[model samples]
Target: MTAHEERPNEPILLRRDEGGIATLTLNRPQQFNSLSMAMLEALIGAIDDIARDESVRAVVIAGEGKAFCAGHDLKEMRSSHALAFHQQLFRLCGRFMMKLTEIPQPVIARVHSIATAAGCQLVSMCDLAVASENARFAVSGINVGLFCATPSVGLSRNVGRKEAFEMLVTGDFIDAREAQRRGLVNRVVPPDELDAEVERLCASILAKSPLAIRMGKQMFYKQLEMGLDAAYQLASETMACNMMCEDAGEGIDAFVAKRKPEFRGR
Candidate 1:
């Protein structure tokens, strides 16, 4: 797959192909795709749209230019009215992040360059992430006197507490390989191979029953916060429910018949 040629007039570009994959590209590369108020609103809107869209089975979040996102727009934060804007801005940002968990569609982050501060938080929010080998990641807000409080929620959950703390405190960059070791990303490939790798991964997921994939993703996150016993209990309950779905029945029948299953996603 070639890099998508973006068209003009596409703010928070949304494109869906025949394969049920939806790609959302951040369109503000002029500022390193910084998270300005407008961009934040656009992103939230796009995610909301995808959540409600049945045609979109898998979603990929990518940036328009070199950087995935540079985090919050520093220029906006430096305005004279910064103090007055924090509450509203944080509320929107927090809500946008939380929405990622609520959505049933599997979301992937296609990271090509640096994902810093909130950008890094965005990566952590994704169900899966594939990065270019040259990509650099950091929670660099602390160095600027702003703690990456929100990012820590996702980062700490993925990586060890000590490792998360080290990145947060030092605001140092970590290469893609270390990011994979730390569980920040699922895989790393060359920049030229990023699109193909992401497409390959998404296609694998798309081949599964949509309902199964949706419920599985939901249960995965829910069980993450539960005790082992509680998690097992939840998993058992979810599996029972999944087995009752039409797709599950078809899958079982197909296996017995030695034929490929055609799932209707019921």
Candidate 2:
């Protein structure tokens, strides 16, 4: 059966598309939008759908209610003590995180408030993040005697090892501006301006050639794990291939003619 068919009540995830941008809002406000099994499945389904949709140029992940996301549903996690169940749950969460990077469209985290534990990891996994001034972040699993092992992967990639480790070990919260300075998020704006800032980023990305964005995003992430020489080799090949596209030709011609280039996502 379809994922939605299994849900007999209110949806845990809400999705809306507008002007080439798809906004996926985590919908468990009363629970602080924690990542339950149902929520993860819903997100995975929505992301798979977005990946196949050419009309979507960008994606925004947002949370409803006061906090952005407080991480996994602790109550649910405690309900099951089986080692196999915990393993499967984490594996599913990891898969959902990796899917963010694999998708062609740029994923932006719209952090309006606190994003703790795995929720903080979710922000780190996003391609870009715009957080409100009031937003706070922490990998707080350590506070309760559980290390955020899975979250450390994405957190370490985004910030310095020392900073990520410090947060992981101490479970201390950092303000939005500090998170930006440490590279956890790209921009921090007033809470009232959070949506506007996110839209600004989406607009900038949407204005670019879709083909180039897709090609570059894939190459960008892959090259990060390669040696300098191999990275350069891959980047050169990507640029060469991008240049061969019709949008590149049109863009060059338009530049020469001093006019706006019309890109058809070629």
Candidate 3:
């Protein structure tokens, strides 16, 4: 049973926070946690809220049920059947994907099962991904006669052009280890150890200075779009500004004093 069929009235997005880590679970387990229009809206609202909250140092995007996400809700798409509607849907989803990288806090995808179509796009867009051994990924929209054009944007950015094209055209699903090898995911662990691995990754990010991380993340994405000299110029300015932050001074001094630097997030 799909998430919509199994639990039609449940919340689409669920949020939980502890120890500076914010987890946003796609809660339509029966429907394979697919991204319907409502689901997209829910995610956008949750992400916007998280962006304004300083307490959220990191975010984990996980899905509940047999699959991480099955991509767009096909049944919903069939019901629309309008060119304008299709365009708007893709546009909204594209904005959501861009926002994932634009956010200050790092976003990590917690992939537990099959991530197909836009589901795979979600994994590619995250700053980092940790998949369970049981996880599988593919942008398989081509199988149904519609090319995964939007998903290709993130997939190509994460992996190689030829490889991304192969998946797009063939609709082949790659296992978690292959996803890792292709640079789509950071690590792949046993299914039973997924939470532990996510926690480990989350803990490492939390240990960094928040201001530095916030600044660094902005520079990281923006610099990728610049030329070598321009990238270095921007990086140099970013570093100079970062050096003047209170946390930078404390971090350098603590290193010399042989003590842990306390960051007040200034």
Candidate 4:
């Protein structure tokens, strides 16, 4: 890697690699990986780098130690020094979550423990998520006098409105299986199988054409806000554009030749 492209090295987070998968571990276990300004900055920088780096195909966001994330740093929030800093701090956290959705590479949240408040927002913002059966999730900001207003943006889009509303208003934790049933997570496996299961899922996504994956992910979110007829029109236009890509041509040619296609992500 280039000098300016060095991997992130910070106490708030840890970075590890395997093939094209970049695993980012939240390191603030003492605080349950709660969002600190520094940690949020590191995460945004890491994701921005991944977007520009051709070598990274997929990403996994997980936490070290017990909890996935407990949301914002409540200790920091309660400080007299934090009164004037709240708006900027929350904006940074929101940007970090939005970056996960905007990045071209798919992000998988590996939830092996509790994820609450903004933590739940992080899970919902990812392209896909796999949780350990022992894991639990909640939007507990309501109990604290905050409404989880920002988290609801992503949570509402992922789960049914009623379910999101219940989680937001009641501030109750739900089991991993219940989260899956409510469409908040894609899969739930045993705690011991969490890492292996995330690898298995990422491996499958990495096998597809990278260019198509990028375009499809971008379009998927874009069309979600459009009217059905307009969305179909946009989709058709996107497909036509995708068909013209070099990877698509090679994919079709390789199919006819009955051989695997070598994609360069052109």
* Predicted structure with the largest TM-score when compared to the true one: 2
- In terms of lDDT, the best-performing candidate is 2
Candidate 3, residue 226: Cα displacement in angstroms equals 1.0
For each candidate, give its TM-score against the true structure.
Answer: 0.93, 0.97, 0.96, 0.93
lDDT by residue (1-266, candidate 4, tens digit) is: 11111224436777887799888888888789888777788899888888987788999999988999999888878874655598898899899998998899999999999999989999999999999999999999999899999899989999999999999999999999999999889999998898889999998988888999999988998899999998999899999999999999999999999998888797
Ranking by TM-score: 2, 3, 4, 1
Which pairs of residues have clashing backbones in candidate 2? none
Q: For model 3, how does the per-residue alpha-carbon lDDT over 1-266 read when each residue is reduced to its tens digit?
A: 11223356766788999999999999887778888877887788888889999999999999988899999999889988799999889988998999899899999999999999999999999999999999999999999999999999999999999999999999999999999999999999999999999999999999989999999999999999999999999999999999999999999999999999998777
Instruction: Count steric clashes of candidate 2.
Output: 0
lDDT of each: 0.87, 0.94, 0.92, 0.89
Better of 1 and 2 by lDDT: 2
What's model 4's lDDT at 86?
Answer: 89
lDDT tens digits, residue span 1-266, model 1? 12222324545454555589888887778778777777677778778888888888998989878899889888887774756588777777788887888798998999999999999999998889999998999999999999999889989988999999999999999999999999999999999999999999998988899999889988998998999999999999999999999999999999999999999989
Candidate 4 structure, TM-score to reference: 0.93
For model 1, the stretches where C-alpha displacement exceeds 4 angstroms are: 1-18, 80-84
- The collision pairs in model 4 are none
